[model samples]
Target: MADRELEEIGEDNTLLLVDDEEPFLKRLARAMEKRGFAVETAGSVAAGRAYATARPPAYAVVDLRLEDGSGLEVVETLRETRPDCRVVVLTGYGAIATAVAAVKIGAMDYLSKPADANDVTAALLAPAGDLPPPPENPMSADRVRWEHIQRVYELCDRNVSETARRLNMHRRTLQRILAKRSPR
Candidate 1:
């Protein structure tokens, strides 16, 4: 499918790497270039947009937070200007809402931070090709939701009672949701 799309578009197979972390962006750019992908790097979302505007890449790896703005804006810009480019959001502060928001805004996938070369490769190339067979839990959306809730609950200092109240959910219901998918 990815091959067919590529052929139809006759576009150069390139990947755009965007992140505020200069070291990580440089490392990823070098790694992908070594792996045979044409890679471009931008240290800020604004820069990424400008770079991509001048020369659109085939795919993009976007960090959610940027020096000037959110990566969601980049996704929106790509969708508007370069509709064929697939974007995969890379985020350190990963959360259910953000992940869902990314997908909703046209990101192909969202991966947590500390992603290595392999993760970067997968994010860039998987939707095009080289995708593994679909796993049982392709996205683990429920797991993401659970983790997000736990993180939020912890931020409230294990105050499940207050967290539940804040979320406008019953304490018992929140407990059930957490319990149903508790990690071993």
Candidate 2:
């Protein structure tokens, strides 16, 4: 897809991000920057619209609810002013009706919160209806340890030692599973 919105807009690959949740904004902003995007953020739909009016971005990630106003307003404005811009709507409270409405109006895709960088990247760059291939399900690691670790990981937000104790296994075993998932 043409990442640039229009012929004259230039290929800055700038992103306009709108979200009311502060922590998610901070984390996602850093993640997007690491992936090589120029990001600008707004806490409200009105502010986002103002920013978009002043300097349009190639892509926008908008939250469905904002402290000041509904994100739908920003999405609508972006669709009107920057017709070629790729727009992704985000909702902490994901509902089928809202997703359908976003698609009908102009958003390229809709995603729920806590989505990782890969999800955002695919939404921003992939062909509208095409999702990336699922990762291979390798069964090399036994499920007993994996599930035990996973249960405690969820309880501790992936903290290793705590998960190990909760699972009654050595912390090193949990670390090994994590290391296996990461690059060498």
Candidate 3:
């Protein structure tokens, strides 16, 4: 799949990434680079579109929301200009409606946020509509709860008090959860 897109653009190893979260962008960019993509990142739809116009990527991972505009705009632009490019849309606010809309607008896959490099890689490179194999060791309920708490905590702008308030949890308990490494 990548080879075919590569042939069209003649840009080996290039990928366009659009996301508003700086930490996630940095982490995923590094991961993708380690996996062999020469990642070019943008934090907004406008920046992504401009970059695509100048040098369209053979692959893209676009977040559903950005600071300046909808990630759908980036998807539309890629579909119009680089139809062969493989695109995966990731979102924190995952919904059936939005997922359907993303695919209808030209995204090859729609993934929920907190997706690891392995998940993104598989989605980008897998045959359309084919799901990856299930994890060998799925998380237990406790682990899942912990992860969700962490996500919400981060979303609350890392305010322990706010996170606790939102989760209806004690501040000290939330801090304890944050301090512990994730359980397998």
Residue 177 accuracy (lDDT) in model 1: 81
Candidate closest to the true structure, highest TM-score: 3
Tens-place lDDT per residue, model 1, 1-184, is: 3454345334576788889998888888887666666788888878888877888887888999887888888788888879978788987667778989998888878787667776666665564554444433333566556667876786677888998987788999888886775432
Model 3 Cα lDDT, one tens digit per residue, 73-151: 9999998888988999998666677789999999998887678887887788787677767765555778768767876
| Candidate maximizing lDDT | 3
True-vs-predicted CA distance for residue 47, candidate 2, Å: 0.6
TM for every model, in the order presented, reads: 0.65, 0.65, 0.68
Residue-pair clashes per prediction, in order, are: 0, 0, 0
Ranking by TM-score: 3, 2, 1
Superposed Cα deviation of residue 25, candidate 1 (Å): 0.9
What would the per-residue lDDT of candidate 2 be over residues 129-149, giving only the tens digit for each residue? 786455333223354344445
Candidate 2 Cα deviation (angstroms), residue 130: 2.2
Q: What CA RMSD would you report for each candidate?
A: 6.7, 9.5, 5.2
Which scores better on TM-score, 1 or 3?
3
